[model samples]
Target: MKFTATQTGKFSGPGFTARCVLGKGGVVKASQKREGDGASPAGTWPVRNVFFRPDRLDPPVTSLPLVPLKPYDGWCDAPDHRLYNRPVSLPFSASHEKLWRDDHVYDVIVELGYNDDPVTPGLGSAIFMHLARPNFEPTEGCIALEQNDLLTLLELMVPGAEIEISF
Candidate 1:
């Protein structure tokens, strides 16, 4: 999959067009909100991993790529912290943080390789591709689509799938 930013929006608070590529399911319009700045970051990124609801009878899995969930999993957005662009557990003090809330959002996620320069602290963390709201509304820095579409994309995905967003 590949994404291109056809316009500008905010991810971490900056202008960036958020054009995304669905998993062979085509394109779906989505929205994002920056953690602090409320500006969407624009650029090329990769699908790092995938997660789904464990309580589900049979959570969907595909060749796109998968990563297990841990109690300590978290996404750090503290641009000022030493581990700014990586995933960190609790006991942290970052200004902008995604604590991997037990909510459905993180329950099914696909981490994006935005600023994953070295992969250690990764580029801005917590980017994912998960279920969208019934209204097909915007997101808080993640891509979203209909459940069926997502499932289809997952089935057609492979590890190292490329996601590009252009403006």
Candidate 2:
């Protein structure tokens, strides 16, 4: 199955569509995507895996691989680091994002296959589809959707499903 998230803030797949929020800087071509630029890379990226906070919610039901998030989970975003664009344990010295966030937004994270292949330094990192804030605020670089909508979509996604993010 294939899903799509557009610049107009619509996320659709199979037979359902829901509002979504993109990066603050909007969407850009994958090649033009830069670290910390606040723009979501525009392209079709595979759904790598799903990570959810077990303390906050029960494991989500989906065909995709799922992992319960650990408090020590983190994603290295420092371009200069060897582990850039990869998951790491906490206390990581390099600049990174704490996957175990205090905010509800990261409670349900859909890891997207962005900047992980060969991981070009500074291209981008930690791009995911996660729960949106109450007001549907823009994300740093990931896509955001309401909790219920995201959960519903996850149930319909298949193993090889990919999300096409476009302008």
Candidate 1 residue 49 Cα shift, in angstroms, is 1.1
How does candidate 2 fare on TM-score? Answer: 0.99
Single out the weakest 10-residue window by summed lDDT for candidate 2.
Answer: 113-122
Which digits, one per residue and each the tens of the lDDT, describe model 2 over residues 111-147? Answer: 9999888789999999999999999989998999999
- For model 1, give the 10-residue run with minimal summed lDDT: 9-18
Report lDDT (Cα) of residue 77, candidate 1: 77
All candidates' lDDT scores?
Answer: 0.54, 0.95
lDDT by residue (tens digit), candidate 1, 1-167:
55443223222212222223222222222223233422334556777777665554146668765566666666667766777767677767775455356455456676677656653332244556676666545565556655665665666667766655544
Task: Tell how far residue 30 is off in model 2, in angstroms.
Answer: 0.8
- Candidate 2: the clashing residue pairs are none
| Model 2 segments more than 4 A misplaced | none
